[model samples]
Target chain A: MSIILNHVNYIYGEDGPLAVKALDDVCLQIPDGQFVGIIGHTGSGKSTLVQHMNGLLRAASGHIYFNGEDIYDKDFQMKKLRSKVGLVFQYPEHQLFEIDVFSDVCFGPKNLGLDRREAELRAFDALRKVGMPAELYYQSPFELSGGQKRRAAIAGVLAMSPEVLILDEPTAGLDPKGRDEILRQIKELQVRTNMTILLVSHSMEDVAEYVDRIIVMNKGKVMYDDVPREVFSHYKELEKIGLAAPQVTYILHALKDRGFDVDVNATTTGEAVETVLGALGRKGTYI
Target chain B: MLRDITLGQYYQTESVIHRLDPRVKLGGTLLYIISLFLFRNFLGYGAAAVFLAAVIGLSHVPFKFIVKGMKAIVFLLLITVVFNLFLTPGTELVSVWKLTITVEGLRTAVTMAVRLTMLIIGSSLMTLTTTPNNLTDGMERMMRPLKVFKVPVHEVAMIMSIALRFIPILLEETDKIMKAQIARGADFETGNIVKRAKALVPLLVPLFISAFRRANDLAMAMEARCYRGGEGRTKMKPLVYEKRDRLGYLCIFVYLAVGITVGRLRF
Candidate 1:
């Protein structure tokens, strides 16, 4: 309903010896309000594919439709399209250079030709949305921890008021607490802003916990596309592609194979335990 | 776009030259350069040729790689050859298009071109065989006497090493920025010259910003790791000039005499 990539193929180093086909004829439709997670191994063209969403990567030969219009059309307003479909890069914190947090987040809105007042207002609003305090606005992002830098960078994109937000490996290399905080913030932002999210991640656990639908990529091709539950249900397929479902789901499958009636839909540990107790009561296997 | 840069250009090998003390290799290179230009007789040139050939053979670096390095300066090489041939007027041989080629001019052009080509190839061969760190270390060791003149020998070597280290990183960052701009419909190619130049601002601004950021981060990281300037800094592997180095210098000395003779030869 919103973005459509029809027959998109991506090639790196087109004229050089290092030429690689990062994506081949990738067709994906990201409708409005779909929280889609893209999972792929390293070098699986995840970055290249998401880059095409906002016209960051022009398909060597294919169509990228945004809001029912081809984004790459000769007459398309790409500047506006990019604002609508914002991409938060991997290690985006590395892009931070402005002296203070406020100026850094305000960068995108100002670049879009907003007046100082309006840009500052948007920056403050975005920072609040990302849970940064007004006091920290004057502090340098370099002084912030890894997670803060990441959130500040995200706020920079959010200041542009993009309807569709894409994050590439948003929680990579972060400690467990930082990872959890970022994931929680992402979920909160998605609901609070009613924004469509396209999260590209290598961690299957993150995909299972958050995304409504999952897309599996393996070596320049889409291996599977379905709801997270349906996609991860194919456990063998996931393992074959160097991925695994959520630990809880995997354990459920393991228990079922070992002569136990573990309800596989219990994707979380608590859900699995509760489901097991309820099943025992129904099956009269417990006193 | 910056990824196209072939940095370091070291030819990977397990040869004795690659394993030799960089200081010795550096000194050998200087002697070799001096020898290449010193020949004044046929016998001297012949001996130099033999000496250079032996070193090249011993280094075991491919000649094709040295030739490839010469390609970057094909225009400069041509300019030197043309300048010597056409500008240096002498006993006339053939005249065409308001330019006269003489027998002497041809000989001068050939010799100048060969000398320049040899200088480039031989130097590049050294670069291809030796790593940049080794080159800098060698320079620092050789320039140790310059410390007496307060020439900042250590500083120069340190700067060179750091520059060499960051060259590839900067190039990579530029490439990433270029790719990022291209994604935003910044047409880097297929535009008029003005538009092309204008398009470069987006690329340049981000690149400069990122480079400064990287430098700041690197400096901080260095401080964190307790890196002080050359003060009290000692080498992990101290260089020792062995008997092989003496033999190399001797061979190069004979070659220098030959190169001087070649310079004087009429044929």
Candidate 2:
């Protein structure tokens, strides 16, 4: 039930003068129900790696196994696999074309050959899960606010009932409130469905707050793959690649550098708050 | 998958042809195409071919690259060849079952093929050597006389240039929309004509909407930047007829004169 990539490599504009090695010898595994965050600067192979997951892209070398089966095998049904593993590209709102919001969401399930009634039911359920109001169901998606359009787009992917949901920068180009709302809903979806989620994002803070595991990429190679705390511990290395740990991690690190007895690996604001409080408690200033 | 298109594509090279005034290249191409039609015999065709070969060699454009454009017009060339080979009346070269391959038909087919090829290569050479912006600039300059007739020549050239620039952008956008629709389980393949056209509804609706959005954004951006329609606009790289451009014009004139003379001479 897990997806495994073995020594995958991909090149763009292959064999031409402008050829680029977009991905190089990358290997990783996403066990079912695991929340994985992939972070990298632009052109660092983050999107290239995610595209390999659902067979949208083929590897130049190596193999991808979905639940212990080779996806590229002669008999493998790619369309079926795509349904089981849904991909929501960045700016997902741009893909909405159906006249109404509900129909747009139903497009995915209907494509899966679900009955009309069943597809509508799934679309309604998905829309509710994304917190879209029932009144907006018949409205044109184009007329919705930016946040509403993004929610409806995610609902479109959710209607497919995919076991694995991979989104590339789901909250990109959103206001702070919109960003937090979308991330919170995604977290709730993962918790409720136990679906394997792979979120590709550059914002270290967003990744730190929700994902159980963080994989950092740099120049077509994996630089670090570990738990959030362990990955954020190497803030110096991450900064070299134009990445950073969550801002709280840096604040803790700054306090530690100034001779405060605090754990510098605290990634989220809550963890940093606790760590600083504990340090102050040890000094008998609080409590 | 739409990225394979190389239309309106410019090949970069440090050569005299690439540096020549785009006006010279445009005028040279028009004159060359006219001369191609003027060729009535082997001598004229030979002169034109040699001139084309010399210009191509001087241009430093790969021979294979220029020849690649010929693949697109292959069907048209084949039809022309077939019509000429079967229909032109002359002394019979070969008589078969209800079909006569006349000597004139054979000659007409060969000359037609040669003419069509030279025409494509001649125009492609101009585009290959000149960038789209420069081509637009040159065209605006050339069409300046039409301004006296209230033709809005500069605006027309500006629109053409903008359209040329948006081709690649729109193509990339199309690819993205296609992928997104595919991810949503909209099958673009394995459908009958009606089904396929219906499927295009999903792709086209989004594409048209995005295109309109892009157009609106571009209009707003132009307004913000004070891009009024082609008035008081000066070129950053003004077109100038250099010594080499004059030489290019001279070469084109000589080639046309030679081709016409060889065409008329009884050899």
Candidate 3:
């Protein structure tokens, strides 16, 4: 199953004097099991685009199709769509209100009409998948540290067992170690489940290292939609629109400019390191 | 969806009315509302209408924008008009199906409708023209005498401005929390009132928590900056009456005098 967008458009406050064209005519497709990262500056329509995938927002024009079914059709059930396409909003921890972490995780499955036993089972499985410790299951979500609360929040959505999981800035406001841990868990989850993942993020480095494909948004339009290497190759154009290629991309480019035989399109640190080592005639050699 | 609220919103513009002291605007709005109640005859209403039109024109805010606020009060307007139309005792003008339409009822209905509409528009004009900070500053200055009774005038104004500032922030927070819960397949729509209220638990808990966190953060930040509750504090942009404010006051008093005189005079 896949999601398809056909020339979607949205305008905020359409009739008011302060109307803003938040999303321009946009078309894209996401085949199942592909990890896609959406990156953009604030107000660049990244969040708006993701909200459209799950039917959280209605497009002012055009159509969205989920698994070949028109989501905007009169008989389409939005609630089912929401269950199938789990969206973990920015700061998802703030949505936790249950007395304990386990109950908070169970909220999603329970909302899907699962029996209590089944919901609890799914919640346990999801919590384990997110690596939430057993001791914290009965503890209040509010009492947990920031990273633990974020993990529990993610598990809440995971308990629904969505076919497509979209996270908007999940690592925001997290310390460096916390950000890496969350991203690693998300990467592991995608690998194990092979579910379609669309991560909306501002960090080019995180997107470059993890996502199979990158979609860059600018001023409500899709500026680039390709593999990370190919998208980061247009670093100059990206910079003009208030975004940049990953730090590794710039480093590799600077080395190439200084007459070093480096792959300037390398978007991640590992890839750039390998390229630099090979250029220095130290391929597969130990220090 | 909460964005529909237009109350307490200031319209940005550069115009004569917008430049006037907020105190003058506040006092003017009060006198204008009182004048709406004082007037009884067409002549008085006509003068008030002309004055309102002049102010609206001078303010440079579009007529449609001001009228948009009236939509919220349509139900109240309808109720008042209906009550005055059917319940007032007077000489009968016409009868239909045992329900008499009295001349006095018609007069009362018309005047009441006009009065209510004008009252809302006039009051909204003040808010639309003045920034919340300036309005509260003007209010604090005007109510300085109330400090004699230990009313904590400055603190009250400070609290009010902070509340005003948080309204938009809280609305945005609520919107985010609502969307997050909805994404979890929690249904907010298509439920009975009790079920709907229950659904709101997920949204409200986080909202309250975040609000408290924000309040704590603000309090700490204020204390860090040596904030001690408005005692011996100096204003950044102090309220002062200008030439135009004097003129604005003059126009308001003249309008009030005309409205009262025309209303009391025999036709």
Candidate 4:
């Protein structure tokens, strides 16, 4: 019911002098039906690690098992595995090529070996799930606005009905409203399907707000893997490692430093506000 | 995956070659190429070879890279060698299948092959030493006089500069599209001719679309930046034809003159 990695290591240009060990001794298991957020600085190997989950990249040394089966086994059907573990890359919309939005979404389902009618139906269902319009099905995807194009790209993958969805920087390069809309859709998709979701982002606030667990990486190794609040609680440690805590965590830390006895372990804005308000009242009754 | 592509791609080093007035380097490369073509005998080739070795040493780029660039024209060099070795007629060294190998012909073949190799290595030096942006800057400055001919020299240079800038961008786009197709089970490597041709559709479709989008965006960006085609414009770093450049040009002229003299004397 989960994807597990045992001693994963990814090397690029292996034999050449330009070879780089992008990931070193990374080991983790993403449980089924859990929302996991991967946060890392640039060159921290977050992107490389996720690419290995599917067969897009093979590990130099490690094993990735899906539901207790090795994905890279000799008898493994990589094509089917790819369909099951759909990856929507950064700026996934840039991968769109079909003349119409409908065909673009249908591309993945068709590749999954669905017949034309079945594929089209799945495409329509996925578009509806992403809240794309029915009338816009025949319109050119290139003519769509940035946010719609982004949604269409997600629908392109969703049409395959992936059991485990992994998105890399899905909300990158969007207006705040567009980012919220996309994250909302992803949340709804996870809820409706009970799928395991791994979201990779550099934005700590985004990860804190959405994901159930945080896996922070530093220089190709896992620095911390815990709940959002627990991870962000180590504000000084994270800052020293070229990372920032969520804004609420930052405010809470400053409040704790300046004689306010508040809980720094709370990451959510609501929880943070309650902690501060409760502290003020208790202190009011004291000397 | 596209990021792993290693094309030597102008590693940013603050060496003398990087600082040389692009015009000097550009003009120097042209003169060196002309001398390479003009060289007739072993002596002229020897002189040019020494000059090239000196420049390579000064540039501080690993000499191994020039060897890598030579791979592209290996076939052409082989063809030239074979044509001169077996096909040309003179003092017979041997005979093969209605073709004779002569002493002079062997000499011509070797010289021709060496000349071609040197030219490629020399030309690649500019690209290896100079980034595309600097190359275009040099080209525009060198062709500034073409304004009298009503040539779109500046525009052409700008286009060349942008084209170079986007080479990596387009390559990255191509790589992305290829991966996307591969994810869809588009087998590009092992397939029959028809199957391979059909497989290319998935990759090519996305590439062409992205290319067009990039072109459209570039046009808008250019217009927004107040880019007007070839009118009055000023250079931030005005190119001055320098002392070393003049000396370099003089050396090339002497080499070419000596090469022509060697041919005339038949020695």
Candidate 5:
């Protein structure tokens, strides 16, 4: 019930002069029901790593195992793997092509050989989970607003009922409010379904607030993998690679540098608030 | 995988041919194609091959890269060869499974293959050496006389260059769309022809919509910049004929004259 990678390496344009090591000797294990955030700068192999999880991109070397089965085995069914580990690509709204949002969401389940009634039911449930209004289900996906379209696209992957869900930058190109809505829905989904969730994101604030564990990647290699607070504690090193900890982490550290007794390891704004109040010996008075 | 398409892609290099005027390269390509039609014998073919080889050498573009462009036209080459191999009337060489093979048919097939190969290689050479901007400038300048006859030369050139520029962008878009669909369990491979064509609906619909959206955005951006349909538009890097351009023209005319004479001579 876990996904494991062993010494995975992926090289783009292999053997050519422009060869780029997109993923370099990476190894990781994601257990069941874990919400993990993968954060990296652009071209840091974040997308490449997620694609490999679902067997979409084959590693040039090493192995991937899903639920104790070697995915690269000759007898392994890739379609089955894809169904169990659903991936929502970046700008997924662009992949919606059905005349209506409901039909588009049913596409994934139908591909799994589900009957019409069952597929429609799954689509209905999935859309509801994403908080897409029932009236918008029959509307053309193309006519939906950007945030709505994005939610519908997420529902498209959700209909498959994957054991593990991977979203690559799902909140990209959304307004701040829309971004919060999507992340909240995703957090609720993970809690309700108890599915292993891998959220690839660029925003440290969103990842720190939502995910339980964080994986920091830089230059096609894993730089740090730990709880959000532990990973953000290396914020100075993270900044050296064009990435930063959440703003709250920096604020807490600045407070600590000014001789305050605040816990500088807090990774989110709420945690920082509690830490600051406790440090000022006024924790119960703030409420 | 779409990036493998080498047609109309410039190969960056510091070489004699790369530095030549785009107009000279364009005219040379036209003359080369015309010479292919004029040639009727092996001697003319040999002369053309020599000229092409020399040009390719001077361009500094790898021969393998130029040959990669030929992979796209292999089917057309096969069709031409097959038609000429069996349909031409001449002395009978052999009969295989109800089809007659003749001496004239063999000769025509071989000659057609050679000519077609040379034509593609020659044209691709020009594009490989010159950027699309330079090619557009060359065509617009060369077609200026057409303006008197109501031909919007500049507009036509602008459209041509824009289309060329969009090829790579559209290719990248297609790649992304395909991957996204595949993630949704949309199988594009491992299907029969009709099923495969049906599978493309998901891909094509999204691609068309995105392309239209991009086109709309580009149009608005151009309008915002006050674009007015190529009227009195000036280039920042105007085309200028250098000394090497003159030498290039001289070499092209000499090859053309020699090719025509060698082609007309009886074997």
Candidate 6:
């Protein structure tokens, strides 16, 4: 019940002058029911790697296994694998082409050969899960706000009842409030459904607060794969590749440098505040 | 699978053909196509094949890549071959139950196939070697004379260049849309032709919307930058005819003359 990539290598435009080695011998195991965040600078192969998880992009060499079975096997049903491992692309709202939001979300379950009634029910359930209002389900997706449209697009994917959901920059271009709402709903979805979620994002703070693990990529290679705290602890190395830990991690580090006995490993603001208070109380110092 | 499409895709290489002025390449390609029609016999086609092979070799583009482009037109080529083999009125060479093979039909079929192949390759060479910007520049310069008749040649060229620029981008967008839909279990491969096209509705509607949105954004950007019609627009890199262009023109004329002379020869 895990997605395993074994020595995967993928190249775009092979042998051409524009050839790019997008992924290089990437071996990773994504355990089921875990919230994982993948972060990297642009063009560092984060998108390419996620696409390979469900057979969207075939690896040039090596293999990807879903639930201990090689997906590339002749007998494997790729369509089923895709439904089981749903991928929502960046700016998912642009993918809404159906006339109404309800029908659009039904596109997924309908494709899975579900009856109209079952598909609609799934769509409604998925929409509810994403916190989309019931009254807006019949409205045109284009009529929705940016954040609403994003939620609707997510509902479309969720309608398939995928065991693993991979979102590429789900909160990109959203305001702070919308970002919080979307991320909170995603966390709740993972907890309620016990579905493995791979959140591909650039927002270190959001992922730090939500995801259990972080995988930092650079130049088509995994530079760090650890829990958020450990990953942020190597913020110096991350900065070399045009990446940084959450803002709170930097603040904690700065405080430690100024003679404060604080844990610089804090990745979120709340944790940093607690660590700072603990350090102050331990030292019996007045603020 | 969508990414396999290489139409309007540029191949960058430093060669004599690549260095020639875009106007010369455009003229050469036109002349080459005209010469292909002038060739009625094997001798003329042999000259054309040699000319085309020489240009392709000189261009430094991989032979396999050009040949791959041929794959797209294989169906049309097959239709032409089948039509020519059976439908042409000529001396019967082989007679089956319902199909009759003719001697002249076989010859004409092969000739037509060669002509079509050469035409596609010649035009592909023009696009492959010349950047879209250069192609647009060359086209605009050639059509400048038509402006005297109140033709919007510059705007037409700008539109063409923009369209050319968007080919790859649209292809990438199409790929993304297709994958997104496919992830939802849309079966594009298994269905009949109509069903397959119906599947494309999900792909195309969004594509058209995105394309229009992009065009709107581009128009806004251009207007923001004070882009009026191509009136009084000075070229940063002006089109200057060089010695290589002249040499290329000479080669085109020589190739056409050879093809015409070969066509005139009997036996």
Q: How do the residues A57-84 of candidate 2 rate in per-residue lDDT, one tens digit apiece?
A: 8899999999899998999988988898
Q: Which parts of model 4 have CA positions greater than 4 angstroms off?
A: A1-25, A57-81, A240-242, A254-262, A273-287, B1-8, B75-109, B190-198, B241-247, B250-265
For candidate 4, lDDT tens digit of each residue in B3-99?
5433436644557676777877788788788777665557777777877887788787778766765666688789899998887778888887788
Q: Which ten residues in a row have the lowest lDDT in candidate 6 chain B?
A: B1-10
Query: Across residues B147-227, which tens digit of lDDT does each residue of candidate 2 receive?
Result: 889999989998999898888788888888888778778898887999999999888988899889899999999999999
All DockQ scores: 0.13, 0.55, 0.70, 0.26, 0.58, 0.70
Which of the two, 3 or 5, has more TM-score?
Answer: 3
- TM-score, each model? 0.70, 0.93, 0.95, 0.85, 0.94, 0.96
lDDT of 3 at A178: 91
Question: How many residue pairs collide in each prediction?
Answer: 14, 0, 0, 0, 0, 0
Q: What is the interface RMSD of each candidate, in Å?
A: 5.2, 1.9, 1.5, 3.0, 1.8, 1.3
**For candidate 6, what is the TM-score?**
0.96
Q: Lowest summed-lDDT stretch of 10 residues in model 3 chain B?
A: B1-10
Worst 10 residues of 2 chain A by lDDT: A11-20
Name the runs in model 5 displaced over 4 angstroms: A14-17, A282-287
Error of 5 at B1 (Å): 3.7
Greater-lDDT candidate between 1 and 2:
2
Q: At residue A102, what lDDT does model 1 achieve?
A: 90
Q: Which stretches of candidate 2 lie over 4 Å from their true place?
A: A15-17, B57-70, B89-101
- lDDT (0 to 1) per candidate: 0.78, 0.89, 0.90, 0.82, 0.90, 0.90
Instruction: Give the per-residue lDDT of model 6 (tens digit) for A152-184.
Output: 989999999999999999988899999999999
Please write out the lDDT profile of model 6 over residues B1-267, one tens digit for every residue: 876655556789898888889999998888888887876578988888899899999999998887876788899999999999899888999999999989989888888888898898889888889999999999999999999999999999999999998988888888898888888788778878999989888889889989999999999999999999898999999999988888888888888887899876887
lDDT of residue B27 for candidate 2: 95
lDDT of 4 by residue, A1-287 (tens): 77999999988757444667899999999988999999999889998898888788899898999988999899998888888888887866447878899988888888777899999999999999998977888999988888888888888888888888888888888898998888888888888888999999988977787789999999889999999988987878988878899888878878889989899888888899899988888789543
